[model samples]
Target: MAIVTPLKTAAEQTLVQQFAEAKGELPGGPAVRKLREDAFAGFEAKGLPHRRLESWRYTDLRSLLREARPLADGAKETEAVTARLASLSLTGLRLVLIDGVFAPELSALDAIPEGVTVHSLADALVQPRDDLGRILSGPSVGADDAGLALNTALMRDGVFVEIAEGTELSQPIVIIALASAESERAVFSRSVVLAGKGAKGTVVEVSEAAGSAAQQVNGAIVFETGDESEIQHVRLLTRQQAASVEVQSLLVTVGASAKFDSFALVCNAGTVRQQHFVRFAGEHSEIGLRGVNLINKAQHSDVTLIVDHAVPHGTSRELYKTIAGGEATGVFQGKVVVRPHAQKTDGGMKSNALLLNEGATMFNKPELEIFADDVVCGHGATVAQIDGDQLFYLMARGLPRVQAEALVLQAFAGEAAEFIADEAVRELVMGEVEGWLHAREAAAEVSTV
Candidate 1:
């Protein structure tokens, strides 16, 4: 008999040990112990993901994790945190997570819409409902990703939002996740949102870090929309300069005549990877996905998507654009599949990228698998540099070379930024892009002079 050596990575081992230790310290009874043990077992069965996993080939976490430690528990709740909150001017029912732990004192939950409930996932597990298990355990038709599995095993605390039938929320709900250290620790969080029949609402999720945080943060969000419902979701990721790894998964199911739209912005993270899986289970459902990423320095950002049309008369569209410079790397992979019975399916996907420097890199893969003879599905990808003619025109009109270059970069990025429906959110993302461009130009000037 041949002996088999365990192929677990160091980070996976460390997480397993930490979970075991934490499980013993919880104040719950036997049932809680069982739940903890079962979760750990699931984690052990599926270890760290590797390059063989198609979704994670370009963004490998096992090889990137040089050290591992437990994340600081409730270390971000301080008087100084108020100052940080004041700068953003966010107005909504806020749920704050400081260093991956919920901060009840900083959170504002009063005056929320009726028929809508928001609470921590740990708290929701104790409630009486079969929907959580049914929705979470469903089979994923997309790639078998390890980052998602790791997030499931190690997730500490995140939001759980559910809307009752026929409820319409006037104000958007905000979930804020903040990281405040540059340690070698890891943060794994999860968020789940479910909308009942005829329900309509909006959700805004934002992630930020204090400074250079050499940590790992993984997240997963599952949205379920019923018949005649609508949901608008926005996700923003802006981490620090140090090495960071994040995996965000969105699983959405649209019912008959339902509409779901989502916009994502990824800026300045060490290594950020996101996957979106949207399935149209009922006829006449509509869905749209838009994303913009601005990566600089040695950062890496990857966005992968899969849209499955299971029924007839379904339509879906996806557009993603990326801007990379200063040795940065970006990746976009999108796939649309239409079943044979799903006739009259209309789907289109486009991915474009701008590489500002020779060291910057981008990889785009758009694929379509159509079984229906009458379906209309198409995909396109483009990778190119700024137009020399445009640059020369701006420089000849009395604009400095650096300023002209910045304007051109902004225009290239603005194509995707203009898709943001919310005016405030669009302005915020544009400001971040401008800041990045200005910093790059300044660095270039100093190097040249």
Candidate 2:
């Protein structure tokens, strides 16, 4: 018999040890225990996904992550966190999580309205629900996905939200995740959102971190849009830094006649990856996924999506834009699947990138798989620099070269930013865009001087 040795990276070794040391203290009962064991076993088998996997070719975790930071001390509240949270200045129903643990002291937990039910993941783990397991490991997601599996095994705490049937919320639920300053810890968190039948609501997923030290954060959100319900979601990444790694995933299931809209903005210098898996379980559902990535100065950001149209009369649209400057790299990948029974399914995907400098990079892959002849599906991707003619046209109007470039980039990113329904949230994203534009302008001036 021949024995084979498995090659493992230092991060993988540390992760295996972390699982072993903390498995007993982690939340969830027997069921969750088994799930965690299985998930970790699977993750151990695969290790971290490498460039060999086409799905992860653009952003290879093995090479990108040389080692693992300490498992996050979820209980340790980072100092200056209050000041950091104050910067966003968010109001109206906020659920705050620090280092992946839900913090009632810092959140609007008491002010939640009557129509929605809010609970903590730790509380749920005390008596896990059968549905909670299903929500955590949905069919749309593969059990062996490294990032997700790690999150499943190690997730400490987060929020669970349930909107009652036919109850529309007056205030948008705001979720703020904060990373403590100078903590070299890896944080994993998970949340579930259920929009009951005929219910309507919006959830804002926001985050802030102290980039003084390197930190890794992995989080997941699962959404179930009930029949005829509507859901609006947006994810905003705060701060651009050179020393952070973020992997966030979203899984959504749209019920019959339900509408789902999601937007994500990536304007940070941190190495980040965002993934989405959306499924249409019922007929006549509509879903839209849009995002913008603004990265510069050697940052690497990736966005990947999979939209599965399993039934008939479903519609999905996706638009993603990227702005890469300096040595920054941006990636976008989208795949739409229309099953045989999914007749009358309509799916369209478009991705565009604007490279602002010679060293910038953008990678895009859009795919459509249609088994039903009655379905309409198409995909497109584009990459280009700012047009000289457009720059000239703007400069002719008394605008400086830097200002002209900002206008063009804003318009490029606006195609997706405009889809945000909440005016305040939309304005927040636009404001970030403006700040990024100003930063670029300042850098240009400094270089010339």
Candidate 3:
């Protein structure tokens, strides 16, 4: 059979053109227009991503887009989704963005203390400041990053959060991206967060589909941290068999004695891809990167990251764990680079996977590129199955065979869940892990019998 070429729908074309036209009318006018035009030009040159692209080899966008078009605008307010917000059991300020557009009516922001500001990008763009423009167009030439360009051209609305200097938010701030009836259509969104000097806060980003509807979501997140400030970021994606793609870039300019910690969880989605870029340019800065992924059936999950050490006396550590079953595939590619002038750099990376079936697959590539003589860097990858002996021991202790299997699976995934700092969040993720294992074991038993 010959492969058929997919044509772009009229809606998609119109969406692209709308973005190109909006650039000219932006608040910043000509300068911002030039930046948007340049990015759009790059995107046009590259076209849509294909399987031939090395970075996108596992994700075939051409095939996925054959039937999808640019998502329609979402509803101004969705009460059904707003009612479900209580289920999150979260404490602190809650900001809602429905289908890429910021919805202040459905959000709860009373907890945000003084000295902090949270508003939509559309509002921020009108402010008489060039900083936002500068950061939005900071990507250099020859970057060859397709997702960033696509987002630049199609971003409808995003969140702009700024934590003032020396202000510390005691409670975590929750940003919820809710997809409702209107969002059942396709949507593209972006979010930017800035932590000012000597500021400290925690942010949790949650994305979920409202009902049993098919939709496409593409998103990007940009984080900027300043000197002596600390930021903890958590990202969670939960959708029911819906195709979603997310590209996250974290840019941290650490000041003396600063720290940054990040956690990413990709549990349920038709297709998910995440990229993390961390650059350390300050002395005595520390960064910790951690992620946990649980994939099943035809799901695909990929996590690619780059950690650059460009200064002296910096440290970074990354640990990623994946559980794959039922023909699922997981990919992890990590690179740590130490420049020649970066002395006293300490970096370590490890990727581990648990395969529940022979059909499941995992690809891990961990690398270190060092130019300095006084730096210490190391990386390792491991793939294995559940220990039969451990399962046997549990079964021998009077537990049923299925119960024993579930316990072993929990033990394997619990290692990564232990790192979650929030007790409530940790418990919620652990419960999900157990539920997945139970469902898998029951299915296996039915097939065998």
Candidate 4:
């Protein structure tokens, strides 16, 4: 008999080496170390996710990531961060994380209003907390995924927000995550947002590259809502590094009679995979998930989501829009699952993509798994180019071809953008959309010239 050992990729080997070297320095207690070891073992067994996995059919990390960069060290107040801070439009309460580490100097920690508590994960890990383990181990959805397992293993520092019961916030809590280009590194950050019973508020997560240097960012956010709570979450990925590789995950558990809404905007990136795993843990809950993706050049962007209806009387709505140009590739994969005992589940999902050039490609996979006969679930997907008639109508009005195309694209993306719960947030997202369009227009002019 011949014995053969499977060879590991450079990235996988580098990850293993990093974990072995940094496990002691990571946060958490004895239990957390054990958790980290277990997670790393899982990742070692499976290696990087590839096209062989059903969930990662479109985005192959093994092939895309040939080598892993060094892990990010602690961040300091630098010129890049200062410039980013100067350019940002201040709104609401802001928390800053530079290179995956919480920055107190850059964050408005003192301005946090009453009834809201903020704790840095690095600081919190030094103390003992009962629910810390549960927060670290996300919900059942995608818990076993290799990428998420890696996140759990080498997770560094993030923000933990807790809303007091029955507290209603007047403004949204903003979490700004910046990747500085001082050096090429890989960053792993995990954050949690807990909404107590009857609490109401909004959270906005903004991710941006402070400079042009490409960085690898593996980030996750967990949202747990108590019964009858209302929480709105918006994730914005704007001005990302052109050669960056970003894998962002969202895990949510909605309680009984709770209202949860989440929206994402992906305007620019090199390679990004934004995935959501949402479970309705209690009955009579409702959720809305929406996103818009704008990609050009050779960039690749993927949005994958799974909504699990594990209880009765759960409602979910998901809509996503993608605009692909140049030779970019876009993917949207949304699945809604109605368990056997989850009767009275109402779920609807739609994915629409627009290709701007002949070489551009879009992949849409909308699915529904209905184990309960009494549930109402439906899904639809469409991939098409811009309508010639609409373009002609705009061109007939003396609009340039590029401008007419931009109008059509904006209107197509607006349908999904309107679902953002907050008006100010919606307008902010649309402004990013317009910025994307303007960049496209400039590129068009350059190409023509």
Candidates' TM-scores?
0.91, 0.97, 0.89, 0.98
Alpha-carbon shift of residue 318 in model 2 (angstroms): 0.7
For all predictions, the C-alpha RMSD in Å is 2.6, 1.3, 3.8, 1.3
Candidate 2 structure quality by residue, lDDT tens digits, 1-449: 99786799999999999999999998889998898998898889888888888778898988877989888756555557777777775566899888888988888878988888888887887674778778878645455478788889998889988899998877689998878747477889998898899998789998667536767888999898899998999999867357788899898988999999999988865899998988998999999999989999889989988898999999999999999999999999888988899999989999999998799999989988889999788999999999999999999999999999999998988889998888888888999999999988998999899
TM-score of 4: 0.98
**Could you tell me how far off, in angstroms, the CA of residue 228 lies in candidate 2 after the best superposition?**
0.6
User: Which residue pairs collide in model 3, if any?
Assistant: 71-186
User: Model 4 residue 224 lDDT?
Assistant: 92
Error of 3 at 50 (Å): 2.9
| lDDT by residue for model 1 (14-58), tens | 877777666554323355445446656765775666666676678
Q: What C-alpha lDDT does candidate 1 achieve relative to the native structure?
A: 0.78
Residue by residue across 1-449, what tens digits does model 3's lDDT show? 99764565543455467665555544334555565677677766666666788766766665566544545465455565767676777777788888778888777766677878898866766666667765664323215666667666666677888888888888777888877754346666677778888888888888877655656777777667778888888778765444554444444445567888888777877677787767775789888888888898878888877787878899998998899988888999888888899999999999999898899999998889999999888999999988889988998999987788788878777776687777776776787777777777788789889
Model 2: how far residue 119 lies from native, Å = 1.4
- Name the better of 2 and 3 by TM-score: 2
Per-candidate clash tally: 0, 1, 1, 0
How much does candidate 1 score in TM-score? 0.91
Q: The CA-based lDDT of model 4 is what?
A: 0.90
Write down the lDDT of every candidate, Cα atoms only. Answer: 0.78, 0.86, 0.74, 0.90
